[model samples]
Target: MINRHLRVVLAEDSVVLRDGMVELLATRGCEVVATAGTAPALLAAVVEHRPNVAVVDIRMPPTHTDEGIRAAVEIRARTPEVGILVFSQHVETVWASRLLAGGAAGIGYLLKERVARTSEFMDALHRVAGGGTALDPEVVTQLMRGGRRGRVDTLTPREREVLELMAQGHSNRSIAALLVVSERAVEKHVAAVFTKFDLRASDADNRRVKAVLTYLAESGG
Candidate 1:
């Protein structure tokens, strides 16, 4: 469940879309502390409010190219504690890779049209705000296609499936349910993936995030 007091800073160039999002979040018990229509304003709002999460659009004013993503990278560097969710109309793998280079915790990249339900969108927001990943399945698929076939090639078909699901930000139990397998089976597959990726147990780093990072890096994204 999402925290009713979840605070958010929204960034989008479209007034209609931005206002719609603000209303949507408000109805779901989230507070939109600030909203911005440009990358500079978005950065300022985040720095000032330090909201739990910031929902950003990929394209904004001026170049209408990568300003949003660039600002997102800056936000990650400046305030690692604030979560960022990229709500874009298109999937730019290179941009996604750059945004996630530092880490996957408290990061999300979701395609706007692909998000079919309100619950799904809210769940993603909650996950990112709580220091979790929320990658879209399509993003995962494209990254896998471009990924270098090194350690990833050695995995069994089932393990690859598990890894793909993991990249999509699914939990072990969720993967098990989707694959129609037992949670124990999913755990085994997850363990194998970590070992294959040379991700050792660590108190300072999340192995799951590490695995996903490896997958993204291998993708050259």
Candidate 2:
């Protein structure tokens, strides 16, 4: 099911893709409150409309560089309340690291091809808007490859599997189900991951973000 009243601010430099996405979102029961062709305009729409979430491109007008990424950074800083989902044709590990720098809550990163998968795209949006996470598996693979093999290598095969699943934005229960184990087992593995990564053990904190950061740190992002 789709969230009929979820408001969104969309930013994309290409008119064709932008319009197509807007239509897609509309059909999925989303309301596109605003659309922008550039980074600055995206910021304006986000600040003004305060949409439930924003679907942004990794590159946008003017320089055709990292405008969208920079805009997402600003959005996260100023309005942490707004969810952000960044999509791009190419994977930019550096940009993904930037978006995940502050935290993983209300954030998502997906390859442009994933957009064609209606259920996954909408589910990612809904998860981000709900202060959850939705990272693409490819993005996770990149993170894993980027991470310090010395550190990541220390984990047992099961721990590595759990870490990979975590990077894909799966919750403990979900991971347990996928692994055919109990939630308590997933919890133990997650705890081991945090300890291994030297991340402080705090159930109240966003350990998911920290775990991913460990991966990013190894990759130099």
Candidate 3:
């Protein structure tokens, strides 16, 4: 008997995982409002039902490359209020960064193995539902690998702060408020950092979060 009653949409290329996830969420008191096994189906479900949260698999059918991440990006651009939780069998930091390319709030990247820990897994769901970020520890470790190469430490303290906050998925305005600065000032800092890294002009089309991650990757952060 579901008790919590959350509106959920699930997307997994694997039929077994999709069905298993639906049952798991259902048993946890969540209402599985919809399910899809492909990226297109996932996007359609998100648009059609406007589910409160989308639990997506990192690899989907067809290419099994980054379909889920692309779908999540679309969800972010189209439905800012719908939370997303990306589950992956491996730690794919590039796609993980993309999943959070919008901002870190209301998003998560968890290892598929972690789903075995029912309590922890469910907590991740609740956190995303509450507009928070839950990055898998392994994912963070993977992202930090570049730190040892001295690529990421090029950032100044302020720049580092901006990058860290950006990694957490905070908007520029929100980061500005947290740092007690004007939004324009924040923009200037972001631009300067991007310029120093030679990424701003090259990645002009990248989303704000994407720019930050690119900078971090270049820094080896």
| Order by TM-score, highest first | 3, 1, 2
Q: Residue-wise lDDT of candidate 1 within 90-209, one digit each (tens)? A: 776666766765557689888988999999899989999988778886776664444334787778999988887776657888899999999999999999998887777862446675
RMSD of 3: 5.0
Candidate 3 per-residue lDDT, tens place, 1-221, comes to 12355899999877886788889888888888899989999999999999878998878889888888888888988898999988878676666666666667788888887666888778888888777767775565575443333434676888778877876677789999999999998888787666554554654335465445454445432
How do the predictions measure up, each by TM-score? 0.70, 0.69, 0.73
For model 1 the local lDDT of residue 51 reads 99
- Two-way TM-score contest, 1 vs 3, winner: 3
Reference-based TM-score, model 2: 0.69
Candidate 3 C-alpha error for residue 153, in Å: 13
List the RMSD of every prediction in angstroms.
Answer: 8.9, 8.0, 5.0
Q: Could you tell me the lDDT of residue 116 within candidate 2? A: 64
The whole-model lDDT of each prediction reads 0.83, 0.80, 0.75
**Prediction 3 TM-score vs. true:** 0.73
**Residue pairs clashing, model 3:** 103-169, 104-169, 146-220, 151-219, 152-219
Per-residue C-alpha lDDT of model 2 across residues 33-130, encoded as one tens digit per residue: 99999999999999899999999898887988889988998898899899999888766666666677565768888898766668888988998898
Q: State the local distance difference test value for candidate 2.
A: 0.80
